[model samples]
Target chain A: MLDLAILGLLFEQEMHGYEIRRRLRDELGLFANISFGSLYPALSRLERSGAVAVTESGGTSSAPLLSTGSLGGERAGLRARRSGATLGTKRSRKVYRITGQGRALFEQLLEGEEPAGADDARSFGLRLAFARHLAPSARLALLERRRAQLTRRLATDLVRASGDRLDVYTRSLVEHSTESTEHDIAWLDRLIDAERQKQAASRTDGARSADSTDPSDPHSGDAMTSSSPTGAS
Target chain B: MLDLAILGLLFEQEMHGYEIRRRLRDELGLFANISFGSLYPALSRLERSGAVAVTESGGTSSAPLLSTGSLGGERAGLRARRSGATLGTKRSRKVYRITGQGRALFEQLLEGEEPAGADDARSFGLRLAFARHLAPSARLALLERRRAQLTRRLATDLVRASGDRLDVYTRSLVEHSTESTEHDIAWLDRLIDAERQKQAASRTDGARSADSTDPSDPHSGDAMTSSSPTGAS
Candidate 1:
């Protein structure tokens, strides 16, 4: 879940790991909490698997100098250099970008079944925060499935409640959850609309990004949005 | 994610591990895939955590035996006697239920953060399936937060695409994702509506059949709903 959330969030925008953590905590409220222990390892694994590439080259030199910790943190620098000090002593903030291969993988993943189990408010929020990677079709499909499932479930619950004495608060609990799901689905539709508008707007530009227009864009370390040398092969 | 998927699907309705596996594959179309290996471990963990319980007393011992794989398997009887055994056997089927505590925790888990990084879709779905156990108010609050976040995000994506000649497909991709998010929010609303009806109906049936009662019904072995008794303290 954490892995999917991370990928989903990044597919929309490039972000540092810390930002990812913050979003997961404050946004989707997913279960299976994401922490440095898990996040860093997962990132490393993704990198190793070629699913992500870090934005380390352009700002590598200035990164180490901006260190907020003790100057004696030379150990950090030394460790960094040890990882292949390809360029001497420059600090680099490792920002990851999803690979086309990763995108295809994500598409396939989204096509699959979703994980189960209900979460508390906080956890679900975190999951949503990161679930931005799915294709619009997949997202809508999942929402529809959920809506149907929830509808049936609520009906069953009502039938069962025919003789029960549940308190108002408890009753509201069910209603609140159902509303939450519905609200989310509606929100997804709006997002789709915005995406369509953007797509239309982009077409008027008449030219692709420098990455597609000029191969030099890839070599230019400063080009954050350049398509990587690798495609979804 | 698979763990949560299994748990959440069960939250919607009780089923055996095999059925859970079948649903994960056949119903949900998850690409990450699940086997009895992962399913059983997740269920075990869930049971230990008090999110799920088994219902054993309902079936008569004299029930006709079927040549089911669960009971015929070596792990059946030994695992049952050691754990709660409830209603499953290689020879018989074990029916698990969700507990109140389990629901609360599932809700809580859903509201927490997911792991960071790309390429974790499998995890994402598993977490989403179980987001039903949270307090109603909290759930709504989380959904609202998600909607706000998506709004901000969709806006950002729009900004990024400005003045760019992004491919029609690429642009479409973003649009697709946005629509899905909108749909999710809408679905949340629907869920809330159905749940309200269910809760309202519950007040009428003060005492109903075990199936009709709240998932917290005591006699149902309640292990499937929450953490096991061992972990309760």
Candidate 2:
């Protein structure tokens, strides 16, 4: 989950560690209390795997000078190169940029089957947050997968509620859980309907435009826009 | 969280490990895929801490025979004691029952201040599942605490949504998250109102019945019932 969040942020822009943490907290509202302990290691892992490249920025400069060395090598070089510089100067910072490998990894992770566990909700949320990068069918599949999971949960909750052993409080908890699951399914239904309509409308437009353009390219302009049903408000 | 769930179940009736695991997965719907790898260790921890007592029951006998040995000692004793018996005899299963310390621990965990993190949702759900054990005041506090948390989350989400850097899909994710948070807060508000009404009704009844009962005894019948608003289906 942390890997997905980190990669998603880097997919947008090159950023230093501090900036990445800030955006994850403020803009994405994820990993709100993520520690530097975990963040730096994830960055290092991605760097080691060649999914991201790290470069060193000068103490006073905003633009990072691209460095070809590894992160450790760059850090040592920076220290040696600046040994005789003025004291009390700011230290260099490492900036990270996603590579082609990272982009492919992000897409793969986003479209992967969700592991059924406690983190299912977070996994789904992260995938939805990056859903625009997905093809139309893939996006719909994501929503449908979530709908199926919640439906299964509702069925279990109903069966539990029908049992005779539950106390008043436990029964209430199950009932409320059932209601919340129902609400989620309804929300997903709306999303799926909107997706189908968008696809249908795009297909109609594609057929009309085919007469003027190449007939071979069917999905000429199928990219999602900001006018998505949920995005409108 | 696992500890609280185990104790809550055992607080009602003595259960073997399999039954406890079953109830947690099917009834609570909280830890759907908890492995015995984690479950047995938790049970052992509870037993070690004197929160629960474990006894061995013969495979053929449904009723567990009371033994005072610790889990390990009992395991060793069982091996030695059953060695002379039939070779095909079923192995004894351990049944766990909450001790006084376990009950105290459960109450403490349920009423403790929630730790803020990704597990906050599961933590709150576990507390609510055992909420009848809490005093009426504590129950209200739980609901109010959840309300406050969701309200804060909604505020952050709205601020993020208003920013322009978000793309179509990221914006939609934020909007959907905001809607869910709003829905959760609204549900909490209804619960809080119902709780207040129940407290008020109980208070009025206490006053009316004060003549026959102890005059100083208030909160006479403030226990929550399954008639809670969300439980009405």
Candidate 3:
């Protein structure tokens, strides 16, 4: 499911494996960044499965194009190192693009909503990680949908957290996880709003942040901005 | 460190692998039970590394008996099946006991207290999961030590959870994880108290829960006789 999400995002833009990893980190804070433990094998698997195709490795002499995606700019340049270098040398990374089959797979993935098991910590992270691979509209729709689900859970947990009727330890556990999910849901809503704003703004001229006084500015204050991009403060 | 913890627990009693698994679940509640994904491999690795040694297989029977002075049980049964099962079930397993090397290794692991990086989720779970493997006295001591750590964390989080804080989303994430860990620490304390109570009761030639008066026993109102085990209730 996760790899499919990564592949779908890559389908939107050709990215080296490292870029895919960085995007996962930046775009989805809780999303597991692809590491050597999983990344190399997953790319190889995707190539074998025909879900992704890799371009030839980049030349050693080209100026390193740093990753500009979400995890801030500090470590982005490190993405270009050679696979075998000791230190300070650039690694050759294979650029991967989603194949036509990959898109169909992603579509299938989006169409089906797997049962979200609340018991698994990994699943919580996985769901949000894959949130971006959905069609932008579908992604917001899912966020609204998930927000509703979490709202219900938070309501129940609040009763538990505030009550003196239960064992203290058990109550705290339920309350803690509930609050965490609630935070994620609220952030998701903000993200959806931001995305919608971005879409509305795109329909006009593509300007960055709106100039409040310029009526012609697409990003004018007339349009409410969504919550900031970082899901967690 | 996790493997060392598991091995140390085994040295305390001749328990089935399932029993060791139970301790993690009921007591630690840290890592989910070692799945077939890691359990079989972990056991194999431990044996190969000579941290443990297998006794003679319960020969010729479908269920085999092996002793590591401390290690052995369901794992031996699994090992027995490993040799006889068809095709895919042929992974070899060997039961093991802590060698002198294993003991020394465990002692070294106990001396370290660094937070292993967030790189491996499994590693985090494993380390926390095996915390109970410390000597009962040592484990309880650590719990006391951790209680202080959690107290400080909970104090900080309590402020965040309170409505006076304005960073709603930020507060949510911090409070959630903090609350859960606090609950876990509290639960550990309860278990430690119960263990201490049981040990003290066992040393005395009296019924457990002997300190509390039993309401059900009409004649027990004034009597100094050992209270029924349910007296505490």
DockQ top scorer: 2
Model 3 / residue A172 / CA error / Å: 10
Q: Write the per-residue lDDT of candidate 2 for residues B128-219, one digit (tens) a residue.
A: 87776766777889999988998887777777669877755557667777877787787788878878877787678884542211222232
**Which candidate leads the pack in TM-score?**
2
Candidate 1 per-residue lDDT, tens place, A85-159, comes to 646644445688888876656544544555444332222333333233333334445545554554555455455
What's the best-to-worst order under TM-score?
2, 3, 1
lDDT of 2 at A151: 91
Model 3, A14-71: lDDT tens digits are 7776666765554433343455677778888888989887754433566764443232
lDDT of 3 by residue, B74-189 (tens): 57766655676422532233435677666555544542443423333333333333433333344345446556655665665555345432222233334455656666566557
Worst 10 residues of 3 chain A by lDDT: A215-224
Model 2, span A74-133: residue lDDT tens: 445656667542211236667789999887677667667887776777788778777766
Residue runs of model 1 more than 4 Å from their true location after superposition: A1-233, B9-16, B26-37, B47-135, B183-233
Which CAPRI quality tier does the interface of model 3 achieve? incorrect
**Is 1 or 2 the stronger prediction by lDDT?**
2
Chain B TM-scores, listed for every candidate in order, come to 0.48, 0.77, 0.45
Alpha-carbon local distance difference test for all models: 0.52, 0.73, 0.50
Q: Identify the runs in model 2 with alpha carbons over 4 angstroms from their true place.
A: A35-37, A58-89, A207-233, B59-86, B207-233
TM-score-wise, the better of 2 and 3 is 2
Instruction: Return whichever of 2 and 3 wins on lDDT.
Output: 2
